[model samples]
Target chain A: MTLAEYKYADTIHRCFRCGYCKFPVNWMDVNNCPAYARFRMETYSCGGRLWLTKAWLSNEIDWSEHLAQILYSCTACKNCEEKCPLRFNVDIFNMIQAARAEMVERGLVPAAVKEFLENVQRHGNPYGNAREGRGEWSQETGIEQYQGQDYLYYVGCVGSYDTRAQQTARTLGKVLLRSGVSFGVLGSEENCDGNEVNALGEETLFEMLAEENVRKFKDLGVTNIVTLSPHSYNAFKNDYAKYDGSFPVLHYTQLLRDLITDGKLDVSGGMNARVTYHDPCFLGRWNGEYDAPRQVLSAIPGIELVEMEKNRESTLCCGGGGGNFYTDFLGGSENSPARIRVREAATTGASVLAVACPNCMTMLEDAVKAEGLEDKLVVKDVSEIVGEVCGIG
Target chain B: MDIIACIKRIPDTSEADTIKIDPSQMSIEKGSLVFKINDWDEYALETAVQLKERTGGSLIAVTVGPKEWDDVLRRALAMGADRAIRVDQDMVAADCHSVAIVLAALTRSLPYDLVLCGAQSEDFGCGQLGVMVAEMLGVPHAALVVGLQEEEGKVRVDRELEAGILESYTIELPALLTIQTGINRPRYISLGGIKRAMKKELQVMSPGELGLTAEMLAPQVKLERLEFPPRGKEAVLIPGTPEESAEHLASILQSAGIF
Candidate 1:
């Protein structure tokens, strides 16, 4: 993939380096770029990375490990796409990713990314766990095995592998079961939906994974999918169609909201908690799903849904996108986006930081511990909260 | 220059919990384990690829394993190797000496200006295969090579020594080097590149095809038992509310005089 291949060869330099792409949607915070916010360097921002990509493509600069590290650090949080004043952000972000795809082709990717891709390639998930255990979370929980269920419960990698995230997966399953919704899981037969793979710039691998998953789904007569992670939802909804995969996909929150609105599910049991929801990057910024989780939260009795200063579209990333949860590329720093977002959540005085995605739950939970706010601020998945009210988990 | 890279596939033992001794008490369970190309072999293959790129030549990657191990060779081909060969063997518990002998016989039959191998395997870590192969092939060998260059029918290599020391040697052509980690960052194997490499020929032959018998290839070593190292100390996970757990931890730390 060349700079020309991203389809931005001619229009790349139209920016004049205004740097508005580094700001949040409100423009009140100019350092919304996660990489730029961490490194505080222009070289790590959207405009600077675009310029570097242009230079490398034109043979003005050689590829180096430092350059790859800088390029890999962008979490693809989509703030740049939201705030770029010139409206050419699609090309700008694609240009950076195209550079990454080229690097992946040339074997010039960072070691962490290489490891992450290799793990996903071999074990069907990023943690490199045995494929047999991929469905272990559904063990004894009585989740159906995709036998003509109304919806296919597509649990993403984190939900299946990470022990902490598995709790949320089971909670979601229990809540859905209690609601009497018909859903079946793929279990060990599941493969990654390739969201992080694509975001990490392994486009070729991502496509192969997506096509394989789509073929499996089609073979099993799957049409409606409800994903446990927003990452999986984003991949199935946005990228899979390029490979002719058009299964109607819904994030779990959307399904829950619908279930609540239709009066099919009850949440009248009053449970009190001052909880603030962190919008996952893929669910909110990527797909523009700003209200599903909030509506679900608002419907719950005895739940005080507080809003952070940065909410909905302007929400800060959890630094878990782009395979950062496995790579930890932006970790070991106070300024890492997840740590920063935890601090922001603290400002709202919310006792619990509720998350809809497993990736966000795992990332923000760790951030809570790293920030030493675990006692004051506990992280809970939205499904966990629902499961509690349903008297299941 | 023509190069031959010897690679291996081993269980990814990065996670300690994934390892379990088999019922035989001599091997790890294989049913639920994940396998990958040895970490060190990546640097070895990358070294061969880099050398081939600098000077126009064909790179051949060889591994001594079963048909399933051909994926590692395919990975090598994707990383810019010209050819891949797998010696058909399924000796999961085979000693390093048997693999070295088989590799030596295979390398003797291939066209090669230089031979490369990883310094050690993640599972075995014997660090003896390359030297044994060199001894059997009667070629000069360098171990723990972190740097390499080809200069006029000879190869110069930097052998990493203990305590951050480097011993450089310029060995003649037709030599072997066991590459150390950080030799050079290995290239990513793209799915597209691998798909393209899938069309390339992956030659497979048995030890008998290489003029060796099962008796001659028999392992000279045997393992009697395997056991995990005993735990030194265990932290008690207090199961309770956050406040109760914090209090328990605080009491433990206070009694230990750490607070």
Candidate 2:
């Protein structure tokens, strides 16, 4: 049997859907599901989805039109798998996405997904905006393109396109340049890593984009790839190989941590402010990359690395995974549990909120602003804080 | 129809911390590298078995990990799969591209109406193997198969899209389909089935058997090293007068976003 068939036939045949893997309390850390932490419903929990998938497979349950909607509810956070005592590989979100893809092939996916896919296929981005003006952030910067630079900082779709995220991209560029790390931009030739596409279950399109990005990276002869977003880092580090290209991938902080560790970076002035680092889900949980950024923070002279109750592998989600940041699908904006996490970070008595990923920055920054606590604390990426300490700001 | 389902033996990520490693990175504290069915593959396997019940077919399981994967393969068999296949060589590199190439070469001779896979593996999260396999086999693929319908001379399918969207298409026979989650709930292995699976046939092969050279297996992405994330300072709860504690608590809660 082919690998695809082998995996499918193998997984479905083995999964029992006993619901033993799910957490009893949705918000409990012992339970690995972030969605349930917010939704507090069996329908949105990993075990519930597993049972539903088993029922559908057994012909005991029929696919209603709403089946697709139910499948997309998960963030694919892998929290439930962590909670499972039997080690059931309960990938309800990802598997549901694959199943939904098959259903889409048979005209089974929700209409919204169909439209989004159509746009992505046409526009080279999931958001379906013009690709011509993609890298507007680099337009005014002195940075050039693919000039045999040792590091090629690939700003992702959101960093390049979204206006708010543009600040993050620009800030990252400035910090890298200030630190004397020679880096170049991908500019218009850049494309989505198909990270979100794969996450959302559009594997074919994800492949196409991955292929394009791989070709571009190879053509540039770029040795090292540094990204502003952890999602992009996770994809390039883990997913790029599927498309036949590979590079050492790092989020900006990882690279900065290396620079700090090697004594390439030295921040002289003592800030005396305590800081708390919020772990991005993709960086921490998805790939087990939780250290380098904090190491950089630790090496700094006077910054105290304050811990939140939920941190590292147990860090609470900022409610931004699975494209939830673009839309409040779960109504987290009105009643955000992540804001509570932000509040938790605030309670650490830290003057600054140190973040690694651009998404975390965006979410926590907004949370800080929304709670009107901007006067008390500030949200900054580790790179940004390092840049400031180095007198680059 | 005869279908073979490919699975993997992944270290349980939940207890990944429990997997203690020495500084050299060799397995020092030999905790269980627990075996479970690959997540997406489970969906694929369930789909194949269910499709077999409808269209009539046999299900065979496949994997490439340590010999211990036989336990997982047996679990698949216990859940109603027919047989098992294992590639019995120490896989040095964990890169997806290399793994896919090896898997494709191994399955080149297998017979089936369709090939199914999860879009990506959970452990590595690389959604490339199924597509790479299709490229190797010179077959059309409909990945992220959210919907499926059998048709004359071809199969109709639905591919999941972003924001709750899906696209409908049709592909000819012998095409690859990457099964998504939620298509079907996978079956649980009964104790009786597990006993029965113990006696089933299991085929094993090595990398050399598949003509994979060390150069081909070399991983493009290197981890360099793994570091533990920095720990936050212990919360120093202020204890004393309400006013003093509240003032202190206010500062702490202010940092934690109590406001």
Candidate 3:
């Protein structure tokens, strides 16, 4: 490709294909890049994609569904960016997303991806359910719609749509009320955070969603937004600001951590369980929120908090990011990263694999069942743990 | 060359869980739902765009709906349609015949070398409007057209049939063709593209503007109450290893007497 055509052509050249992006910090294993780890192919890695992208842009290769799938397979977990020693690590993920944006402009995306985007376009959420149902879960959950409340509970698409994740959303609401935290939910008024939309390469649609949400938040006078999905938290906390949306955002785990630290809620520690926290890629690596979830988990009196070898920044992805949950690119295969993550979590000897993001909760839960480890290990959201400990669930 | 593409706005039922019968039981409750260009209509719009690109024609998109349907027409404009038209109305349940009458009236007024329409509307699936419009206009018609090619004075089409069969036919120019799905990959319109197309010609006309009274456009058929199908057998979630699941599925197939 011409140097001027690609946005980060210079930085992309700086990659020099060192291959460090395919390993963890410990380098004990090589399956660090989730797509590469799953595919066992060089073409799926960050550097390989970069080379392919250059060739395709330069007209050396024609675009194919295979190339698009490889590009779309990335979860944008940032593991490759994290492990890369190059100074242009930040450009790596953005470059992949940029390439996807180009592919979207050309209408060369996967069929599932097309359906995913068309749904997100029609419905406010990616699930394609009516917007009315988005607010239906807040009923009977003691969560009121925001009317100048202290914080707006911005339940992202998964929590608002998926039945299993709805429990986590409700639990978060209950936990907040029990701790006497002042919060109100946007309910149906809350739009998709457009984080995954941005990652999926619908830049224009993402901009529309982000702008509309920001305008609505500004109109509501919302100062803080607590999200049940790390996907939304990442977008609200970081990406929104780029569009002139400056609002404080916290993953539910961060707020739970704060509540426990303030001693506002009483935990009898009545029930005991062995649990390990699954650091969501968006929460931990994308935003560097390693301690908040862990600190809250540690404070629970009846819990034995353990760690998997691949935890925190070096954590394996749930293979649900970048709209992969709806795309099913990672499922139906043993090499699915979520299955790999659950199998690793099983090694920690913990019965419950706790997660902070709704996307992660769904991914790992299915992965547990797919790997036939559901009987041995269960997946639960971090809020579920707090709900259990506080006798709220 | 001139081409006219008929489109419709329909509530997305991709996720059927949220769809419900309205209080009147005649139509779906679309107040909280999202509406989009009908799926087959999207393919039709793409087909018209592709034909215009290759044959150097002015493509005009037309829809029969209320004011909110302008979004679909705007999208059509962004997809390279030279202009858009909306037959404004206030019908909650439009029948295929009524819509065909309106579309045929609109088609008669325009200078069109060819007419294209979706095989069926998503919500109704009547599969009648295109052929009915063609009959009213007294033009040759091709339905379920999976492929099309322009000739000197005619258009050749591959009509889809049941069981993956295809029937080829060549219809004369100035005829109507109802496009099937996968005729082409529809282009994605950026928000910027739509914003730019907002400046394009988008004409809105009521039935009165077409010299048609409310009675002339009234639906010939009235919809009865809609209800869900009766549940017969309960569905069981078959969860286990792949081999076990396969064995379970084979038994299920056998119970249905397929083997």
Query: Which residue pairs show backbone clashes in model 3?
Result: none
* Clash count, predicted structure 1: 1
lDDT for each residue of candidate 1 in B113-155, tens digit (9 for 90 to 100): 8999999998878899999999999999999999998999998
> How much is B84 displaced in model 2, in angstroms?
45
Q: For each candidate, report its DockQ versus the true two-chain complex.
A: 0.58, 0.01, 0.50
lDDT for A168 in candidate 1 is 92
Tens-place lDDT digits, model 3, residues A1-393: 353687877766566777888887778687877888889888988888888888787777888989988999999999888888778887788998988888877666888887788777877787778777788877887888898888998998999989999999999899999999889998877788899989988888999999999999999999998889989999998899978899988888888888888888666574488899988899989999999988888887778999988888788888999999889776777888998889999998999999998888888999998888978899988888888888887
- Candidate 1 chain B lDDT trough over 10 residues, lowest sum: B90-99
lDDT values for all models: 0.88, 0.71, 0.87
Q: lDDT tens string, model 2, A332-355?
A: 453464576668888998989988
* Decreasing TM-score order of the candidates: 3, 1, 2
How far is A223's C-alpha from truth in model 3 (Å)? 2.4
> Candidate 2 vs candidate 3: which has greater DockQ?
3
Once fitted onto the true fold, the runs of candidate 2 whose alpha carbons sit more than 4 angstroms away are A1-32, A64-66, A90-94, A110-112, A333-337, B1-259
- The residue ranges of model 1 lying beyond 4 angstroms of the native Cα positions read A1-6, B19-32, B89-92, B206-209, B213-219, B222-259
- Kindly give the number of clashing pairs for every candidate: 1, 69, 0
Residue A202 of candidate 3: its Cα lDDT?
86
Query: How high is the lDDT of residue B223 in model 2?
Result: 55
- The digit string of per-residue lDDT tens for model 3 on B135-202 reads 99999999999999999889999999999999999989889999999888777765656877999999
